[model samples]
Target: MRYSKATDYALHTMMFLAAATPRTTIGVQQLAERQHVSPTYLSKILTKLVKAGMIESTTGVNGGYRLKRDWENISFLDIIHAIEGSASLFDCSLDHGPECLIQRVVTAAEEKMETYLREQKLADLAKELNLMH
Candidate 1:
């Protein structure tokens, strides 16, 4: 039911990228400093995001990370899946048939949450943040 700090960091990092809507790259050290986290630790998480195609990593002295897609198309679920994977949060270890009522209930709940997240675009929130600042 709970997501890891990695997911938390990824969501925040994504929000930052979406809000800034920067064309230039943002250094990992700068991102880490802003979050008060270790650059090394954040790099690992960023790698997952890169693999997910949500962001790109640039190389060289001015190299860093930047959003690869339009922020308006990015959803909360996308960033969450990049860090948490799309695997079902609840898996019944016991050998239960497809008729398992508990499994059905949990699956329905998960689907509802997923739908909400999928529809909630990060760009909308970022725009609101911009207004606040």
Candidate 2:
């Protein structure tokens, strides 16, 4: 399955947060502008993140949202799970609906892909993105 724009926006937003000062709140408006995403949609994405305990939000002057935990500890799979839920590609067996012989091959391939993604940490992505030198 393809990733939704929500996931892209979430990862971009999280990368910025990871690079920013810790414990410092970042306004949604500014974050949206920086990430080149609409504030309305970004707000929804941020809400999901906050609910997942990945971020903390505060209202009032000099307040916005901040990461609840260290970026190094956050994984790409964690973000994917938070936004997309525990969804899987090969959720069904081909043989369950039809007499297909590709079920095992499809399942094995899907598992390998999932494992690779699960091993990829958000920190790894951030480092890749920050590579300018």
Candidate 3:
């Protein structure tokens, strides 16, 4: 299973925010430059994050974006869900068929991955990356 490009950007963006000073707001253009992503694309991702309640945004001269919750409160799964809606790695579309062996295996793997991601917080990831002080 693979995550979408938007999911990758969301994860990176969240990590960047987590590494920044608490309550610090960053402009999309600046963040895009630092992350080597297009501002237009990043802006769309940021909007999804805001709508998901994962990040907050403002307008005007001092306007920018900031994490809505502490990094410790955010998880990889949270970011995944915010961007991809669901973290299920399997598309199990065989509801009518008799039991599919592959479906069982995929479901188990998806569950395991979901558990792992839920246990991993953004703060812990930042610390591992040495982005936390």
Which candidate should be chosen as best, given lDDT against the real structure?
1
Please give the clash total of every predicted structure, in order: 0, 0, 0
Candidate 2 Cα misplacement greater than 4 A, ranges: 91-100, 127-133
lDDT of 1 by residue, 11-111 (tens): 99988887776465899998999899999999999999899888899999999999885657889999999899899988877849568888888989999
Model 1 regions more than 4 Å off: none
Model 1 lDDT-worst window of ten: 15-24
- Note the Cα lDDT for every prediction shown: 0.89, 0.79, 0.84
Our model 3 lands, by Cα RMSD against the true structure, at 2.2
Residue lDDT tens for model 3, 93-125:
766433778887778778888999999998888
Q: How does each model score on TM-score?
A: 0.93, 0.81, 0.87
Q: What C-alpha lDDT does candidate 1 achieve relative to the native structure?
A: 0.89
Q: Model 2 over residues 4-36: C-alpha lDDT tens digits?
A: 889888877887887675467999999999978
